[model samples]
Target: MTSMSKSKTNNGNGTVDSRRQEVQRIVKNACDQLNSEGVDARNYVEQLAWLFFLKAFDEAETRREEEAAFDDAGYERRLSGNFAWSSWASKTDHPDEMLEFVDGKLWIKLTSPDPKKGLGDDPLAERFRR
Candidate 1:
């Protein structure tokens, strides 16, 4: 019998940390909810889109408020404002750049066409389409 060689696997320790664990927990909960409703987790594109929109909206609003305060302070320093929602889109005219900024797995779930055997026919999708 030939000996089997084990390939070295990187766990991406550089990217995995406490913060990543928290995010994973949140995603797992959402998936679990979908599973309980007899809905395929992969068909959660609509939910993902809504969440993304809310998150981006909150971030953009917070950044705008912070930036305005800085401007009022007469601080002519460039603030690394949080790029989310239309603020992120406005940052770059290039489609690629716009995509790059929101290229996380959550964003992919929202924008990808018929991802994972295509989105199921559901009211959530209908609402999202609007």
Candidate 2:
């Protein structure tokens, strides 16, 4: 195996190995569920990747905002309010509600940017616009 793969799969700790296995199992279960619904592995993985990307972006933006606040500097957020993952994902309790938000509002916000609607001209938002 490549050194990178080996390093990732064998971290020289039983606890890490067990946790890795658990994560793998959870991802596999998710993939299986999507597959059962006629979603191909590639499509499901891409969707998962998009969700993960948005979540990570939100976390990084939060950190940057905090740092700017501490320094008494202004920090413009790329995602906030309902566009933020924390707000939409956590606040929407029901599956149907979440789906509706994603399919309707979230999709429009991401795919069709409108400065008038507050999906501003930030770098990340501009990328989505393109």
Each prediction's TM-score versus the true structure: 0.39, 0.68
lDDT string for model 1 (22-49, tens) is: 7779888978877899998668866576
lDDT of 2 by residue, 1-130 (tens): 9999888777777797887688789788988888899988877776677787887889899999999999999998767788889988785459799889888888676776557556464455576665
Which regions of candidate 1 are displaced past 4 Å? 1-17, 73-130
lDDT of candidate 2? Answer: 0.79
Runs in model 2 with CA error above 4 Å? 1-25, 91-93, 114-122
Report the error of model 1 at residue 113, Å: 26
User: Which candidate should be chosen as best, given TM-score against the real structure?
Assistant: 2
Clashes of each: 0, 0
